[model samples]
Target chain A: MSVTGPAGFRAAGVAAGLKASGAPDVALVVNDGPSHAAAAVFTANRVQAAPVLWSRQVVSDGRVDAVVLNCGGANACTGPGGFQDTHATAEHVAGLLGVSATDVAVCSTGLIGERLPMGELLAGASAAATALDAEGGPDAATAIMTTDTVSKQSLVEGDGWSVGGMAKGAGMLAPGLATMLVVLTTDAEVGPEELDSALRGATRVTFDRVDSDGCMSTNDTVLLLASGASGARPDPVAFDDVVRAVCADLAGQLLDDAEGASKTIEVEVVHAATEDDAVEAARAVTRSNLFKCAVHGEDPNWGRVLAAVGTTGAAFAPQDLAVAINGVWVCRDGGVGEDRAEVDMSGRAVTVTVDLGAGTEHATVWTNDLTADYVHENSAYST
Target chain B: MSVTGPAGFRAAGVAAGLKASGAPDVALVVNDGPSHAAAAVFTANRVQAAPVLWSRQVVSDGRVDAVVLNCGGANACTGPGGFQDTHATAEHVAGLLGVSATDVAVCSTGLIGERLPMGELLAGASAAATALDAEGGPDAATAIMTTDTVSKQSLVEGDGWSVGGMAKGAGMLAPGLATMLVVLTTDAEVGPEELDSALRGATRVTFDRVDSDGCMSTNDTVLLLASGASGARPDPVAFDDVVRAVCADLAGQLLDDAEGASKTIEVEVVHAATEDDAVEAARAVTRSNLFKCAVHGEDPNWGRVLAAVGTTGAAFAPQDLAVAINGVWVCRDGGVGEDRAEVDMSGRAVTVTVDLGAGTEHATVWTNDLTADYVHENSAYST
Candidate 1:
């Protein structure tokens, strides 16, 4: 079977005994490339994971040939010892692939502050490298998940090259980007600079807008690798389109699998003074627990929405704002507008639209309604 | 059954049909004195409640003889209509007591935006006025609660005067004073200016430090009424001490009854460059969901705590920070210091200390653990 992205990458996943549940916890990705150009986005959180620190240095040279990812142990807050483990992991992967150590990237997820079980991880990495195959993308996707109920993979097939990626995270999802670990691989002939620009542009609207729970993580990393095997150097605009589609698809999967989520909420803020203001308004409402709870209960509580929006520093006269939920205009000119009973929210997707009546700029943020299951899952999560 | 505070004030509470639960919802406090002075602190949220707007104007005169409180609807975001409801509620109470409406302060809590059921509320106010007695303080406390599992009341008896207060709130609790609605009654013979100074000073360390969830509310208000009923004036220091004690006790109650809260966590930041910096650091960790969840699971996740502190805009070298959880020094000099396996978390109260190693300034913020129950309660709350 052909992998989703480019044509010259092989992937493999295997159980590494890192998770008590015995799920697939190790993945290896290798590029058969003309040029090993890569770009990565690490979590903006100051509390960096050991692997993220290692990967940041490796990607500084703007080239990479392989990525080694392990789930079920986020080697974060483990001090210098954890950094050594990440370095060893990268070195081992580089030796196996016969590449420079700096040409290998590493990622880890799961619990924080725990030392990586290096003995088991090294053995698993060796087994995963031996098991690598051209059609192992799905297995690799499955291996990177923790707490996520399903594997998240997205692909956008283009004329000469394709964009394919996978993401994992169910909670600790919020702006500046969710606590997601993502890897995008493509055979498209794009340089590191172009890839970096495209990835940042794509993520700003897609992954960066999904807030499951208003929490930032200590370990979130998104890496994009361009093998240039297809030898098709598309224009920046076309490359951006592919990146957008892939990011949009992955974001959808993340929301669909949000922890204890019953409904995926799309908050669209339009007619704002600027795109930043629009995004600010939408995100403020998205992070509001009262607003999310109202959505979960199928109550078109426009009052909560207005209250949430009013708290944002965005300048707007109350009478100039309009709000609608599920296509029903529930508030206009900042007061009650139509019958809230007209809203229908008995589905998995819900939409809230706010018109700032200030300017033409707009933004959209995605979130999930707070649910009892979310509480149940998180309250007992650590146990 | 004497009220704890002043000598010439009577208080009463009555049931109103505004709440679906049919709990007490109307409270009345009357000062039978010649001198009446009042001061208030409203929610910092820009989306002010109708009551807050009205009380702000009334308290501007610095003289109020009575405070009428009802818990059924927050009367927030009801637009101009909400302001009218607040006005009419105060007028009704004032008319029944044969006093000017300007001398009466009004407060409301519960769901936001919905108009109060005037027919039931007016009748309840009439009943509360007739039932006013010194022994009705506890009943008045019960009437103001929304989702609060218990009533919060405190008393500080001084040589010449006394301070007593009642507070209510359960969710949307965070710094900038939480979602609290408090009424502090004092018998101290002080001017409105002094009352204001003491109130602000007391709140800065007490109510301002309790952060249950990060969400701020639109209806939080704290009113302090000086009846001057005792006819005995005390020194400023003694009066301030009484105010501080009352506030601290009420703040403790608020944290204990926080929504979905099973344990109260105290985050103390010490040796900071400034008091504001110390408070900021403590509050940052208190508001972190990751840290709260770790505490909920009885996991001494000090790394999450340090990560939270690092994210704050406060300036501090990571290596100069020390962290202790539940009296166990978990990290010192920015790295692991104690055996994680030896720490204890078997109690419902947890204390976390962070030393910045900068100066002597210190601050403590109270918070509650994040649990599944919190998620469960909030997710289904609106329904």
Candidate 2:
């Protein structure tokens, strides 16, 4: 179960002729709710996709009746015609569900700089609406995938309600969101303001901390829909916790399925003057291609880590920095410490700890190692 | 002829057993000057190598008698002992040249975080000093080699004066300098102030614009020693032009020799609000791994180019950005224009031009494509 794990939600996934492999490329999730409260986050990239522009307006009023997503065409950089296509898709979906077009959100993923095949998409949307079921969350999760090898879904139960979500993405993962589409649903009775606040607080630390390849996408989206079908007015703090838990679980799945990644790296920055400084420092190290390659080779090359840290404007003296690979302190006081051979890196998970020795704030960024497969997959993706 | 192409300069190279391959790993360049006016620039990275710390102080007085450079050990992150080793090397070179140790500059490049073998380096310094000759510039250039396949040398002549320089680096090439050491000698009668100004201007547009993999090294040094042997003070503008020409030539060579790169990409950002905006836009494109990989695969994926440009704060509307690969405009007004198939990417030299449509300012940045060999080389370099 994904979005449909919560009550008062129905979802369906249908095969559209958009993807070359004939995989399911269209999904629909409708909120048959007593209350229609929603919140969303879009990609920070100024070159946003057609659907993102359409959906940003749809969710602006803090109410969303439904969300429709498609893979196999990013529909970005397609100009006015692309925007028209996105608008037409939302209108078509709204007509079938007896809702206003302004209440429907649209999301798209895949290659950029191309137009979508509207004929197959509209027919697929009709099929998805007809096949909507309360237990179709997994199918919806599977449909919104581009390079993802597996569907991502998570459910967090509160006192008498639950929060559930689904995510899809592989590459182009970085700060300000990635090439991922996430749809979250909750049965708790919450207002639009509370939903928006909870969603922002959750994603700021979860999806926002995942950096794969440091490539920001033009079609990233995350939406949360709330319905009062559970008749549970849970505490706002508990609701926020459940939302964050679901988001964290989905983010982890995205990292686990990152494109061509052989190792998952967690770059932890500690003892920073501020939380922003810690995040900045951690992100700098996570974005270092040299350091990622070293991790792939299983070499405790702390010099590359320190070099990356030196590139940031964070407050910390170079000589006061210390770094550890796994559990071994490979570098202390900015110099060689423990024997590099003692640090084992054969496992698929690697942790690098950097102590800035500045203050008490800290942050951890999730990333993946750079491999030849990553280069090969991305190089052959569009052409 | 390289550094020794000018008068009043002697250079020598010798094998010091520091390199396991039994290759030459030590070089000595002496300025037997009528006037020893010198200026130098080191890596901007705060975690600099010990030699950079020593050389920064040596060049503070605007005078340097000699420069001794070694390969096979960067002597970085080796604590106070590393600084002591650099000081000792400078002292040994100064003793041989009968000059103050403060006037002797030291440079090192190789694996970081390891102490250098001082015994072998000292002995090699003695050998290099004894073998110094006026025609040994090429030999000295060959000595300071790590992963570089070939030596880089360039000469630019003026009226009865010339500027000659040698450089060594193949990877870790990015803005704020790279993992390179450069020794430049000129027979022009110029003061230290003029030399410093000309060098800064020349390098700002030359070596500083080459970004390969976006990894800044801790051991980057560029030194220019002016010897008034020619007794010819050409126009400062002409002298600056010669220095810039030599630096541009060497920068080109570095791009050509970038590790595992099959294509040399020149990203030109035109019609920017300011020169800084142009440079920032160009550099963002150059540092994009996805764009680099697309170039490596011979794919005219203009979407990646625009995606990179969107990450910058440069003043440009999404609807006004246009990109041209080679001579064909593939994107116009942020949308697809010409057929991408019309843009040929079969050549080793690829040019990507982005028109911001904001102002008249422009800039160009040189970079290399990301490839499997690049990942392989960096992954296995230190292990």
Candidate 3:
């Protein structure tokens, strides 16, 4: 159960022949509710997809009745024609749902700089609208996958309501949102402003912390729709926590399915002068190709960590820095400390902890090891 | 002839037990001069090697008598004890040459976070000093190899003087400097202040633009020593040009020998608002793993280029951008232009030109393609 796990929601997925392989490439989710409060976030990349530009306007009024997403073609860098394609898509979906075109959001994924197969896409959208069911959340999740090995969905229960979400991203995972598409639904009686705040707060620490490849995408988007069907207004703070938990769960699933990744690494920076410093330091380590490769080989090369940190402006003296691989403190006071042989990295998960020895703040960033498979997967063909 | 191509300079490389393979691991270059003038540049990384700290002080007074370089150990992140070792090595070289220790510079390369075998290093320095000859530049160049497949040497002749240099670095190449160690010798009658300015100007475009892997090392150093044997005193501008030419030659050689690289990429950003913006935009493209991988696959995936450009804070509207791969205008006005098949990438050199269409300034950054071989070579070893 994903978006349809909540009340007053229905979804469906259908094949559109957009992909040469004829995979399911179109999905629709409708919010049939007493209240249509919604919020969203998009990629920070300036060169956004046509769907992103269209959806930003659709949710600007804090009201959305439906969402239409398609895979197999990222209508990015497609210029004015692509924007018109998105506008037509929204209009078609709104006509079928008996709603205003301005209340329908659109999303797309696949190769950039290409136009979508409009005829096939429109036909698939009609089929999806006709097949809409309360149990179609799983099918919607499956339709949005590009290179993902598995579909991702999560659900968090509230007192009398619940939050459900699904995410699709396998590579180009980075800050300011991964190359991802996420949709969430909640049946709690919450206002649009609170929903927007909670979504931002949750994504800031969850989705934004996953820096798998340090490549931000032009088509990333996350949307949350709330319907007051449950009539349950739990504590606002508790509602926020549930939303965060759901986002965190989806983020973990995305990491687990990251393309060509054999190990999931958690880089934790402690004793930072500020939270921003901690984040900057951790991101530095996560983005170091040499460090990522060393972790891939389980070499326990802590010096690369220090070198990566040195490149940043975070407040920390070189002499006061320390690093640990797994649970073994391999470097202390910027020099060799315990035996590096004691650290084991044969497992699928690796933890690298850095002690800035500065102040009292910390942050963690998730990433993947650099592998030959990653290089091959990315180079063998164009995505 | 490399460093010893100039008159009044003696250099030698000798084997030291520090290297497990018993290869030539210690080198010495001496400036026997009527006038001793010198300038140097070290890695910008704050967590510098012990030898870098020692060499910065040795060249502080704009005079250097000798430079001692060793491979097989970087002596970085080794704390105060490592500093003491560098000081001792410099003092030993000074004792052999009968010069003040303050005028002797030192450089080290190889694995970091490890102490050098002081006994073997000092003994090797003595042997290098005893074996030094005016024609030993090539041997000194060969001695500084860590993983480099070939020794880098260049010579540029002036009116009555000449500039010659040697460099060694095959990986960890990035902005500020590759993980490189360079020594240049000149017979020009130039002052230390002019030499400093000339060296900075030369490297700012040459070595500083070679960002092979985006990993700045802790032990990068470049030293220029003038003996003033050619008292002709050529035009200052001509001397600076010669230095720049020599640096460019050596930088090209280093790029050719970059570890596990199959293609040398030149990312040139044109029509930028400023030179700095051009550099920032080009560097952003050079550092994109997806773009690099696409180059390795010989795929003219121009979308990756636009995505990379969109990540920078440089001046350019999304719709005004254009990119050409190998002189083929594949993307114009931020969308598809000429057929991508018109671009050819089946060669060792690949040029990606981005037109910001905002102004008139331009800059170029050199980089390497990401390949499975690069991942294997880096991951299979600790260095």
Candidate 4:
């Protein structure tokens, strides 16, 4: 259920004064590795957090000793001082762990465009160092939550190795890696290159497709640390599959707990000209505020779906398109078909299947309904 | 003001049974002209409505004698029968006006994926033909409204000529013409080519930048007709300026009457490297749902603005970007700037200005705030 499920990780969560609510807001994950091989991905947004910039340089060398994550204040858009603050934090951790400062990855979340409480967070980091234990995964996950109602953690058992990860994001979730902060750990004997390849391949089909809010964040980062403490060389293909499974589990959890979302929607586009086309079609529908509202109201308004589809240039004739909501073919051949009244939408999970009838390629994108709660939660307060 | 504000035009509106509520749903504008020069622009969406397809063909020869519009059912995604419906409507109008069918332009709006009530609409068309009058502009404007709270009209006077137009749209309003149906007329002496250039120039800075809700329509159409009745061939530059002014007025009206909107936001991007860059930057901020809701709550969350700007490739360093809300520079040099609390946002109109600090080019985009009423109105029933 957590990154510590792997053999070579030690984690801790500590309450830092960085958060106004006085909740646990600092997390530390240490790879006490026999091998400190690592790979990572950062947010594609050009307006990145200071910590993301710091960690990008660390992971560039495919080696890391520790990761310090803080919530309550995103160290983003703070100019040069923010980057220096991140450097100081990493330097403090490097001092205690007796490792090079450049090997420590720093991650932060919460309100963007503000500086972190450097003094308080640094003190919390020192406390987390002494608090690290194998059972600290749950606490670590909790420390990284912003508006998330629950902590997200996943563990995948492999033949002779194991992969586990934790993610934190409740809003501003659109692909380029799920718009969140994630930390993954494994006990497999793998090189940094293999880990990078496997991580990218896994995320391409998993985290990269979860588009909850169509808004990307400034501090999204995913790190994979391979400690090789299990002393087992798992098959690369098998290891990649396990990593993907863990990522998928965490991605679904992110969507299920999306900010103020009541229903989790799965948009599947089939028979497209290419996988890219299928993704384009699915994303277009997911981004339609009108369609999202219709889904929220439990109205099988296939018309909104068609309007969204029409906005995309995916290779398909409008006349040949079909849309099925919750297994009811509400629109077929681009026209009304089954009685929409027959579709029941009382459940928390809903599926919209669009048949492009163009080619064989297909893809599925996950999203959430646009609810009044979403508007209220987003508008009533600043996160 | 409406199409008949131009001397050579006659207009009418009639209630049709096409709308479930029995609202006026049919409008006609005829050019009783010495000339029939016309220009039109349809939605760029590939999955166009049947009427859009039919009208695109009619306007290609650069002449149109009449325009018929209905706002009860969007003849979109209804397949071949929908095309036939638009064609029959055009032919019916052509016979009554003593013009070729190819010279009639048709427009439709309302719920998508449903067939129009051909029988009732045709009957309404006959009634509207008989009801035609020089004083029928306001009635015509009222007939072509869907969820719009008020009719949008604008009039611009030239030396001896005048331009008047009406627009209808409340949702599914995005670029590519704001998902609207509009008919514009001028008594100025001008040919089709000049009319096309002026129309395109006008709309590019007007309707193309009105991105309320960011859902492009499949049935958006705008027509500009010249009757040559005033016999005043004003300077081309002056005509272009007048056309742009009228378009800006109509675009503003559309924003004011947007469905369920509580605020009309004007986003102006300044000091960009190019006009295109300014537009891209402005549009990025307007599309951010988080920022829209913040504006709804009047939180003055300028961090969201910086986050949105960071997503674009516009030429400006993160540290060089500045954002102002309602004349208060809330974010300067990408960091916290003036006191956000100093800004007043109690009014229905709000303005956000971003300084890219790249060059002198600038552009402005208009949008509406996301509100609970919007979700309720769009979700409670399909339109």
Ranking by lDDT: 2, 3, 4, 1
After superposition on all C-alphas, the RMSD of every candidate to the true structure, in Å, is 2.2, 0.9, 1.1, 1.5
Q: Which number leads on DockQ? A: 2
For candidate 2, write residues B228-312 as lDDT tens digits: 8899997999999999999999999999999999999999999999999999999989988888889999999988888888888
Output the lDDT of residue B49, model 3. Answer: 93
Ordered from best to worst TM-score, the candidate numbers read: 2, 3, 4, 1
- Which candidate would rank higher by lDDT, 1 or 2? 2
Interface CA root-mean-square deviation for model 4: 1.7
**Residue by residue across A206-259, what tens digits does model 1's lDDT show?**
888887877777778888988888888887898899889888898899999998
Q: Which ten residues in a row have the lowest lDDT in candidate 2 chain B?
A: B303-312
Candidate 4 structure quality by residue, lDDT tens digits, A25-51: 999999999989999988888788899
On residues A250-310, what C-alpha lDDT tens digit does candidate 3 reach at each position? Answer: 9989888888888999999999999999999999899998888898888899999999998
Per-candidate iRMS values, in order, are 2.6, 0.8, 1.3, 1.7
Instruction: Evaluate residue A87 in candidate 1 and report its C-alpha lDDT on the 0 to 100 scale.
Output: 94
For model 4, the docking class works out as medium
B98, model 2: CA deviation in Å?
0.8
DockQ score of the complex predicted as candidate 1: 0.48
Summarize candidate 4's per-residue lDDT along B1-383 as a digit string, tens digits. 67888889999988988878888999999998898999998898877889999999999999999999998889988889999999999999888878899999999998888899899989998999999999889999999988888888888899999999999998777889767998999999999999999999999999999999988889999999999999889899999999989888988899998878999999999999999999999999888888999999998998888888878889998889899999999899888888888999999999999999999999999999998899898887662
Let me know the TM-score candidate 4 reaches against the reference structure.
Answer: 0.98
